[model samples]
Target: MRISACCFKFLAIIFWICPTAIAVAQSNDAQRHVIVISIDGFASYLVDDPKVPLPTIRRLAREGCVVEGGMTVSDPSVTWPNHTTLVTGMKPGRHGVLANGVLVRGGIGVPVKIDSHRDHSDLVRVPTVADVAHAAGLRTAEVNWPCTRNSKSFDDQFPDVPNALDYTTPRLRQELVKKKLLRDETHASFRNSSIVGLDYVWTEAACHLIRERKPHLMLIHLLNNDATHHKRGAQSQAGYTANAYADMCVSRIIDAIDDAGIREHSTIILVADHGFTVTPKAIRPNVLLREAGLLTVENGQLTQAQVHVVPEGGIGLVYCTNPLKASEQAAEFKKLLTGQEGVADVLLPDRFDEVGFPHPRDYRQVPDAVLVAKDGYAVSGTVTGETLVTTFEEARTSYGSHGFLAKLPKMKAMCILSGAGIRPGTQLQDVHNTAIAPTIATLLGLKYPDADGKPLLNALRTSADAE
Candidate 1:
């Protein structure tokens, strides 16, 4: 009787452990893994350069689909709007991000903080890819992704925000505490002075989250390169170093995923918000238009002009009140701007709109005239010596700027897709920014509503088989 009882107990233990192990293995296989990595300020040149030691990225390109020239919609090409477009798959106008800084009503003295959170509701009109993924029963996570703060999209998010001004002063910790923005216990963990390029820290936090709570879909945005370009310019050694550092961070995350034993089952997509350019001279087209009587100022505010130019610092957008007047203004602005110390080319709004950007509903909000500067020329709003000198000259130390027309050779972003369900060694050209979300949805078998981006069927094995 005793021997029979022991035998029964042994059998029951085996029954319990065996099913648990098998269930875990099955769960790993049944679920799909997706990781979207945004390397801020990444231009196509990095991957194209053999000398750059981006081994993981190189492997992805060689093994996965590579969109050699991923195009951006339009300019200021600044971070917030560009990043918003990537996940939302909508143009700036549709999504309403508009610029890094939106003009406040009542001319509020300070610029509204435009970090990954929509402090004002209903600003972001569309659903993010993560939103679609979650609705389909997939888990989601984001790290340092812009405009993610207080976002309703992600299941788990570590939104990026500008380091508070007090962060630089002695009262940093106290201010963070008083505002209830961070806990005192977190002070030691987040005590870095230069928060801009803290890719390693961001990745560390992400890795911990991945291990502690395995998310099916994850989005990570690394900004070392962007910061380096903003401070050192795009072509400088600092920018190169920043790129290499970002690549290293990417490698680390890949290793983390591998260690978690999800390498083969996971798909990794690497992309950039926009490319960068270096500007040497700063041009203020509004001042010139003001002088030309094409623009007028009343009560310290700018009013209607035949051609209105808004300085994005590096590139200027021109809005024409009269479409007929555009040609005339273009001719005159061309004569007035070209080769005049800092000017590059004057682009008409009609030609500018051809990049597939819809016209702004509020014409008063967009520039009637647009200006492209030479590699070193930047635009400004300050007046000095007849020419409006926004900053005497564009900052020389920074190596990066973007927001020029996508047609420019230097303005192309990069895209790499690799993983279990993806077709290997596929090279796609002419992929638009809008197609990213749909592609992600197709991979996970999720329903993405109102997505502007179409899935490239050729890039996915499952998609091809389904077709």
Candidate 2:
């Protein structure tokens, strides 16, 4: 058989172009790798601090892009809400995760309780970064990420919730147990495990996932730093030790990525849910509500109440239980809370949006009003205590807290992006926590136009620029 010159040329071109096109496709897949790490209560101010021994975090910041003033987290700067916002790129109002737990209202005069035992579907209303990535045919994993209970978005998940062990992926759990990284598959075992020990296990699990699953998008959260900051102040010696340990954990994850032979292609982003403040004084708002005849207590138990105030660390969510006298009750409650010591500013329903909160009419999780605590003070839900305020020495439990207004400088969270496609040595100004999801979506070449945030274009290197 005789091959014509034109056919031979076409065949040669096809063979030459196919390999180059395949290599390009492989490179694109490699560049799509992204891993998000959330160190709970890791304040951005500590990033450059000499006292805080965060060598790994510091190295990443130097080698990659770092937000100068830190990432300003969403209002009611708590764990679940902020973390949900991190992945969903939506505020509590939009994402529907208003608290660390879901607020359950039990009719009129009954104090609302935060139920932390809810599933991800009930808590997060919007699609997360994991969901979008998975829908786009990318493998995703979540390790100890809050509000991820029973989430089907990720290929692998170890949710951060009560009874976490019960909800962990069975195959991964068995593997971890067999490796002695996890104890028994009981909630009691998980509960009894030390915070530091859990941190270690979560990191190890993430490392294992990276090496084995090689997920395109992985979310990891560590809780030891947050626990330490709550027990001891953020600047306390114990907190420093916790930070150092977290840095080591980050180093381990990096090593795992390297061991997986994906270090060149993998991008790691470090972020935090919220920062911490040393709250030496605790203000019991429920006591004030009681004294004002808004609520009645019997036998140290809340019996009947016209209104209820749920203390969320640095802020109080004031709820008017009686809809009949809602306005009257709200006005009176505001009057009582206005001049109280340790109370900063009271935000009425109208001002909720200013703080990135949804109106109660829009979302049931929202309270009638918000009570902001003064600096160095925290709102307490203690109603039985006779004293309206408790000093640090008296309370003993008063050490640190978050859940403060997002605008506060103390609530600034950390944001560090490193590795593939990230612009090295880039310094960004203060970024919104919501921007994270969009940035991650951009990194993976996925579309998330509904996100309230815009991608951090300055921190990302374009293909043309890379070339």
Cα RMSD to the true fold for all candidates:
13.9, 11.0
Cα lDDT of all candidates, in order?
A: 0.62, 0.85
Error of 1 at 386 (Å): 4.4
TM-score of each: 0.74, 0.92
lDDT of 1 by residue, 1-467 (tens): 11232343354345333433212222334568888898988887677765566777888888889986565444556676677777767666555565564532212121112233243123444556665666555677887776655555466666655432222223433443464444452534464536443576667656655665567888888888877887677667777777778788888888888877778778898888778777644666667767877666776456445655545545666555565455576667877777766676666555545543344333223344567766655666432235644343432223346766566667778888998788888999888776777777677766555556677677888644547
| Pairs in clash, predicted candidate 2 | none
Q: Please give, for residues 313-359, the per-residue lDDT of candidate 2 as tens digits.
A: 89988888766776677777788888888888988877877887655
Deviation of model 1 at 288, angstroms: 3.3
- True lDDT of residue 248, candidate 1: 81
Stretches of model 1 off by over 4 angstroms after superposition: 1-30, 69-76, 105-117, 120-122, 163-192, 195-197, 286-310, 317-352, 355-357, 362-369, 384-399, 463-467
Please report the candidate that would top lDDT against the real structure. Answer: 2
